[model samples]
Target: MVLLIGSSMFAQSVSAADPSLAELKKVLQSQIELMKPELKGKVKDLSMDTKMSLMAILAMHSRYSERATLRQVMTEVLSDYQSVLAGIMTDNPEHTADSARRLANHRIPVGGLLPYLGMENISDERLAVLDSFNSSVEGNALKLADAAEAGDMVKAASLIGDISSGCVGCHGVFRSQPGVSDLLSLK
Candidate 1:
């Protein structure tokens, strides 16, 4: 009876370790799918906005890697970002102002990744990047979230690039962390 009780407790403990990775992946994928058309429509420059979005998504991917099962899903999501950015960059350089307006609607989700990453306890260097980004001209432009809502893709894309640069700078630091090199390389 003692051994059985011990085994049962151990099983429960193991089961409670983390949420199902598959479920997490599914949720993330669904979110992306739902956001895509909206994303394509609202941004003037897909190249810049896509890169910014990928950086944000990668931040989430970093968190998902904490679990083994979710690692595969994380990889898939990262690949999607890469592919989308590549396609956008390679395709057209010009878009209708109306399309840009539509894409701007996704600003909330696009920008929301910053706080999510912060919740993961961003490094000091990363925090600095975020600060710099917030104070930048482009960042200031985004403060005109109202302008973006009014279909100002020009202002929105500019701000989005600044945000993307911040993410890249931080990720550069994140990847260089002593033990994370191997993990980052998977992307």
Candidate 2:
């Protein structure tokens, strides 16, 4: 809410002057950077009791409800990746590189969550798994981008599979509908 209010104020200031898109983006990025430290402080070094409290608060976040957009972006990037592979197989580096660049440049808001640390350096194990998953995804995405930029279709082809594995693995763990309650399943 604060951020939105701040952004609106910033926008109002610029709207009268008709700032360019690039200028608005720069202002937005600067505002976000200014907020980062304060934002990070809120969630950092939480106690166990705080974690429990946060669980209640977070229950209202609609995170699962938000996954559809993430999935759609992933599908688009994956589709571009498929064309990249086809281009590689057909010995068309230009097509392969073009598609790969398209995949690399895809952007969206709210990619996903990262792991959190608590007061004693403890973390939520589930979020830890997601952090690992995100790392794998990021590394593979970078490699895929680099390979494509260098017109190394063979490398890009291999990376697409690796990146797909990261996505599949994360979805399997977090997105699956379980047959039993975790407590009952554990027993």
Candidate 3:
């Protein structure tokens, strides 16, 4: 795969160039910018070496910024979300309510989500965006719990869809990792 080859090349370059983490990150950002047009379906004759270098840089950069605790919390939330879905499908109100409540009240990591997300300079606008996403998710989650408690599976199903949308929308905005569609030819 191109990504694998790119990462291998990047690892080699990191050792060869001996650049600081900051320098590598700078290169990675620029490379991603360069690839944007190509990624968006424009035919750019960017060199394979340059493309591979970008991949390698991204691979190396991600190693330095891995968020273990945040990942763990997200894993827990995902599990709870699945449990809620399971409960709803099986018509178990207690199970659905409990999982929905846990999802709504999932613990925020120390220093909060934004810091863990590596937003160095927090602006009110960014904070507002995050708040908007969080509010939608939490509000819908609570409504899900209420609906489950009241044995209204129809309402609970709709709330779950809303919660899924909120999570995906927030991740699209804040997550640094490139998705499959972002990296590979999609035709």
Per lDDT, the best of the predicted structures is: 3
Kindly provide the TM-score of model 2 when superposed on the true structure, using C-alpha atoms.
Answer: 0.46
Tell me the tens digit of each residue's lDDT in model 1 across 65-132. Answer: 22222223324434433433342344322332223222222222322232223223333333335435
Candidate 1 vs candidate 3: the TM-score winner is: 3
The lDDT per prediction is 0.33, 0.46, 0.55
Better of 2 and 3 by lDDT: 3
Error of 2 at 48 (Å): 14
Clashes of 2: 0
Model 3 lDDT tens row, 1-187: 0111223334455643455744554544343333334332321233444444334323322222222344566777799999999999998988999998888777533222333333331333343455456657766888999998998988988888889998898777766642222332112
Backbone clash pairs for candidate 1 read 41-99, 41-103, 42-100, 42-102, 42-103, 42-104, 43-103
| Per-residue lDDT of 113 in model 1 | 33
Worst 10 residues of 2 by lDDT: 178-187
lDDT of 3 at 60: 27
